[model samples]
Target: MRSTYILSFLRISVSVLFYILLVFSVLFLVASIASIAGNDKAGDLTKKSYSYRVKAFGLQNTNEPFTYSQDSMVKYQKVADEYSVVLEPSSTIGYYALIMKLVYMALGLVILWNFKKIFKETSFRQPFKNTIIKRLRTLAALFILSDVIKLLDYFLFNSYLHHSIASTKFQLLTDVGNGVITGLVILVIAVIYERGKELEEENALTV
Candidate 1:
């Protein structure tokens, strides 16, 4: 009874999260389309990156995406004056960046929805089934794919941002930690569980 209630709760919660993510995915898709439509000259821009307008001494992400010249000689009042005097050009790469972010979000939501279905299908009465094992394996592969896609996005962002700034190229030189490992572990578990199920069926038939 407790396990039944637990699974029911999990299914409900996961379904809610899945629906919320779906809404965001649709919004992102619309925003991506609107971006191209709104910016008529968006394709002509050479710099393929969204950048922070260096307002002060620090760098931070902002709604206003552009690159600008900075000066230490100017006063606070003069800063605003200078800002209006110069406007940094927008880039077409910003749209692609938004798409990358949306892809990441969509991937996470899809995995969550799959897990929701797994929980929904699970029953205390039926412990050994190939379907559950298959889902687990599929989820593991998705986990690894997610990490690879993330790495690709990071490389693309860094490359575009560097070109926009005329800065030295930076490479991310490290192994993907959590997602890869977790996926492998889940894969192993699924294999073992499937083998166990096979043995149980074989034993039942032998009698």
Candidate 2:
């Protein structure tokens, strides 16, 4: 009874969000195309750079303002530990940012698509199947991929940096890292659940 309530709630909530994001995704796609078609004036309204601060310890400032190096610190750690943070400029958005938005919206659609599908399965009171496992795996992988894409997008726009982000005012990357970890945990659970389902099917056949 509780699951029914929860399932109903999730189905309706996610369905609404799904359609809203679907519309946004289509808009982003259209806007991205227009930007590519040289709709520079219109594009300016939709895309802009953002500024953010990241506070990291032991950053060796290059003193030139925009460039900083953590080679020594990374060597000491024996890993590529970066003291870098890049944030979006709240002032203006551009072509590249519009493309990023398109990617983001598309990824969100993928997530919501799977979410709605999962809810449908729950609503039907269906047994777990291989397809469900695949869907769960996809959701987990997408969560991880979303974070990775964000990091990559930041680095790609490095040329846009007027200065480095070196403030410690509540680093947002930590939240992204947490998401990555959560995604991994979910992936593990999906794998385990899938295996259990397979075993149950096997036992049923043997009996």
Candidate 3:
């Protein structure tokens, strides 16, 4: 009975961890989208800057065959500004980035919900085999799905996108961490579920 209680405690702890990860993953998805959108707005502002009047101390002069002059300086500045603006970071990766993020978020939610269900069953002293197998299967599916989304996110956000090199690396690292922690939580839950099943079987045999 004490051992059973220990297993129950471990299972609940893992479930809590899974929930925490789910919340964090959702927050990250939101942040990523916001960041991409913010970049897009910045790029637009830069493009608009091209039309901005360049104010420099200069006397009115005639154009010298469009060669070196104040007019030329303004033109060159405008060109450079346009190029910089167009190249500025944004979620240019488009729908792909959004899709990947949604996938990951959905999977995380599923995993967390099922974990809560499993924890609730354990709290009610339900038989492990009957209650846990389905939950474990659900968890396994979510875990796999999360991994798939993570891989897609990596490729789309880092490879196809034009984000700053540092930001890309940071996003990849955070995604990897999320995946690893979620996977570990699932693994721990599986082990606890199996142990509960073994306990149930042993009790049956003794009875």
Clashes of each: 0, 13, 0
lDDT by residue for model 3 (77-132), tens: 23211111122224344445456546756765676677677766664456566566
The alpha-carbon lDDT assigned to residue 180 of candidate 2 equals 85
Best by lDDT, which number? Answer: 1
Candidate 1 residue 73 Cα shift, in angstroms, is: 39
Q: lDDT of all predictions, in order shown?
A: 0.67, 0.64, 0.56
Ten contiguous residues with the weakest lDDT in model 3: 48-57
Ten-residue region with minimum lDDT total, candidate 2: 73-82
Residue pairs in collision within model 3: none
TM-score of each: 0.69, 0.63, 0.46
lDDT by residue (1-207, candidate 1, tens digit) is 888888889999999999998898888677656655555664454332233332222334234334444864543323321111111234434655666767878788878977987887787766667888988998899899988986887667556655654543333333566788888998998898798899889989999
